[model samples]
Structure formats: C-alpha cells, structure tokens
Target: MTLAATIAPQLPYLRRYARALAGNQGGGDAYVVAMLEALVEDPRLFDGDCDSRIATYRAFSRVWNAMTTAYDAARDLEAPHHRLDKITPLPRQAFLLTAVEGFSPDQAAQVLECAPAAFSKLVETAGREIGAQVPADALIIEDEPLIAMDLEHLVAGLGHKVVGNPRTRSEAVDMAHALRPGLVLADMHLADGSSGLDAVNDILKSFDIPVVFITAHPELLLTGQRPEPTFLIAKPFDEDMVRAVISQALFFRTGEPAPAA
Candidate 1:
C-alpha cells in the first residue's frame, strides 16, 4: 500500500489527539494538515522500522513542536509579558499518548522522540500537574452498579466529590439539574435504554458543563459527523486513563482557555 493509504485510517485518531493536545479543533487540524504536507514533500520522514501508527504520530509530533515553537517566538515578540497565556503542552501530550491513544510507554517515547525513562518523568509531571487542578463536583451516569461505584471512587480519589450516580437518562438529567455538577462522566447507554447523549444534551441546554463520556465503543461517537464529546474513557478503563481524562477535560474547560495553538 502507498504511505498515504497506510496512514489514512490513523488520521481520525491523530486529529483527535491533535484537537485535545492543541485545545481546539481548528488549530489542531491545522497542525495535522501541515504534517501531511510535510510528509508529501519528504516521505522518508516516516520511520519505516516502527509501526505505521507510531510513525504517523512521531511525524506529527515533530511538526507540532516546530510549529508551536515558531508560534511561541512570534507571540513572545508581540507581547513579551503575557507569559500566563501559554499552555505547557508537552506533559499533556505525553499523558494523552498513553491515556487516550493507548500507546505503551515505549511507543509513546518513540512518538515523542524521548528516552523511555524521560517519558516516564514527563507522565509523572503531568500527573502532578493534574493532581493540583481545582476540585469540582462530578455526576456519574452509569447503569452498572459496579462501574458506577468504581467511577465514584476514581473521581473521589482525585479530590473531586461525586454529586450523584444516576441510572437512567431521566434520572441523570434530573440530578444534573438539581445538583448542577461541574463535571459529568456518563455511559453512552443506560439500563433503561435511555441515551446518555440525550441526557447530556438536556443538561447542556440548561448550563454549560464539561463532559467525559465513558463507553465501550468510542468509535461510534467519534464519527466526525457532528459535535462530539472531547473526552472519552473506554470501558474497562484503567484508573490512570480515567484520572488523566477527567483532569484533562476539567483542565481545558475550567482552566484559562488554551491560547489557540
């Protein structure tokens, strides 16, 4: 297969990572486009020895780093004193590679072009940064008792309080309206066949809230057809992934808006 064909399937996922890492769809997509153009000009930039997925990400990393550095330089020249506007993206990128993209530490290290030990350090720093985030009340919308309990524990472990766990869409909406949670962790499907999407939509209409969807089939929601959840945790998710995503969602939404790439 051609190089384009080999990497085509990974583009959506790359876009997802870019969007999350860059903190907006437009800027993230721009970086992905630049990376693709660069690849067209120099195909050998792709590492043939590694998995195609890893190589694609590695190439994007180089593009992101280079472009962002240039962006920072220009911004610095324009406003030398506005240092607080910058978002420290490296730690978040490392966290996303392992937590959201499911890359192992070694593979994520290759993507970042860093030593494995260094990558571990990056993740550790990311964790500490995430841990320091302001606590927020969270609502858990899951039908499963065990999963709901697990999610509650996880959310609580991060110093956030769980306002409630609702089993159905109606209950979720009602609870959200009554409690006005700062965060929502929801399953796509509920026991009553009520859609979590519907409940979330109702809640969003009432007030703006950061949402993190938990589902087994994340691809179903990542269709790129409509506005979708920016944060997702796959079913049977590890504690680390849940913590990272929860912090990421809250960090982006509650924290100062990330300056556009």
Candidate 2:
C-alpha cells in the first residue's frame, strides 16, 4: 500500500495524540503538519520496519522531540496555550502514550526511542507525578441513573469532587455553566433525546474545560469532525480506561497529579 494509504486510517487518532501532547488542537495540529511535511520529504520515515501505526507514531515523536524553531514560530503565530509546563515532558508523554493512548509499554518505548527499562521509569515517574496533582471538581452528565451513580462513585474515588450529575442535555449544560467543573464526563445521548454533543458545545461556549464523552455509537462522532473530543469511551466501558482518560484530561488542564501508584 502507498504511504498515505497506510497512514490515512490512523491519522485521526494520531491527531488526537498530537493534540494531547501539545495541549490544544491548534498547537497539536501544527506538530502533526510538521510530521507530515517531514514524511513527505522523506518517505522512508514510514518504512515497513514496524507496524504502520507504530511507524506513524514513531515518525511523529521524531518531529515532536526535534522541536524545530519553525514549528514554534508557527504555533506562536497561531496563539499560545500553556501546557505541560508543570509536568516533566518525557514522563507525561510516556504516561499518555501508554495509559491514555493504550499503547503497550514495549510499543510506547519503541515510539519514544527509549530503552524498555528507561521507558518503564518514565511511565512510573509520570504516574507518580501526575497522581500527585490536586483533585478536581468534576461534573457527570448521563441519562442512566445507575451509570451516573457508577460514574459519580468513580469520580469521588479518584479524589475529585462530583459537582453534579445532569441527565438531560439542558441539565448538563446548566450544571456545567453554573458549577464550572474542572472536568466533565458525559454520555452521548440524554434522556430528552438530546445530544451530549450539543450540551458540551453549549457549555464550551461559556467556558473552556476538558471533556470525556461516553457513547454507544462512537462511529457517529468519529467522522473527522472539528472540535472533536480527545477522550471517549464506548458503552459498558472499562473502568480502568475511564479513569485513565479522565486523569489525563485533568492532568493537562489543572496540572493535577496522577493517582497513587
């Protein structure tokens, strides 16, 4: 297959990772653009030496670590956002790559171009430092009381306070605006047949914060839409996955520490 074809299917997710690394869509996409340019100049960057996904991330990491001044100029011109200022870069990257992005330790090590042993240390340090962050006040938006309760329990267990659990699109937006939660966990569909997407967008219009969407029909939202959420989960989601995404989202925003080891 052609290089573009090989990378195209994974591009959306790669963009997500880049956004997380850079702290915002604009800056994140800047790095992704640079990675693409580098790959275009030298197609060998995606050589079949590794799986296409791995090769793609490895190529992006090369661009990220290089941190060329031109890319900085581009991002500065785009408008700057403070991110990763408090967390150690390698540790945060390692943690996000492995924990939130679901890459195996070995795979993440390969992408980061670090020895497996060293990569382990990076992941460990990241977990400890991130877990050390102060807890955030979180908001839960779901139609199902059982699921909402479960989410509330999970949030509280993470040491974050649950500010509200709103079941409808209107309630979700209202609670979000009123309470001003540091993090939001929302279901895709609400009780009134309204969209969590709509609610989150409305809330975002009033304030900037991290959001996690839980959906039964993720394919509906995966259409390469702009303002896409970086954190998402499928119905009957894994608890570990939910916790990790929430932690990662909060980590970038509040510089919240990661959970205990």
Winning candidate number (TM-score): 1
Model 2 has an lDDT value of 0.75
User: Model 2: per-residue lDDT, tens digit, 151-258?
Assistant: 887677666888798988888877776777778898888899999999988988877788899888887778896656788888878654565566667664543322
Local error of candidate 1 at 152, Å? 2.2
Please provide TM-scores, in order, for all candidate models, with all chains considered together: 0.58, 0.54
Q: For candidate 1, lDDT tens digit of each residue in 1-261?
A: 899998899999999987666555666788899899999999987887899999999999988888745233223322211221242567767877877788866788899999977876676566556645556778999999999999888777767889899989999988888887888999998999989988999988878888999998798789999998878878878665676677667655643321221
Q: Which whole-number lDDT from 0 to 100 does residue 207 have in model 2?
A: 72
Go through the candidates in order and give each one's C-alpha lDDT. Answer: 0.77, 0.75
After TM-score superposition, what is the CA distance of residue 5 in candidate 2 from its true location, in Å?
21
Off by over 4 Å in 2: 1-94, 99-101, 104-132, 254-261
Reference-based TM-score, model 2: 0.54
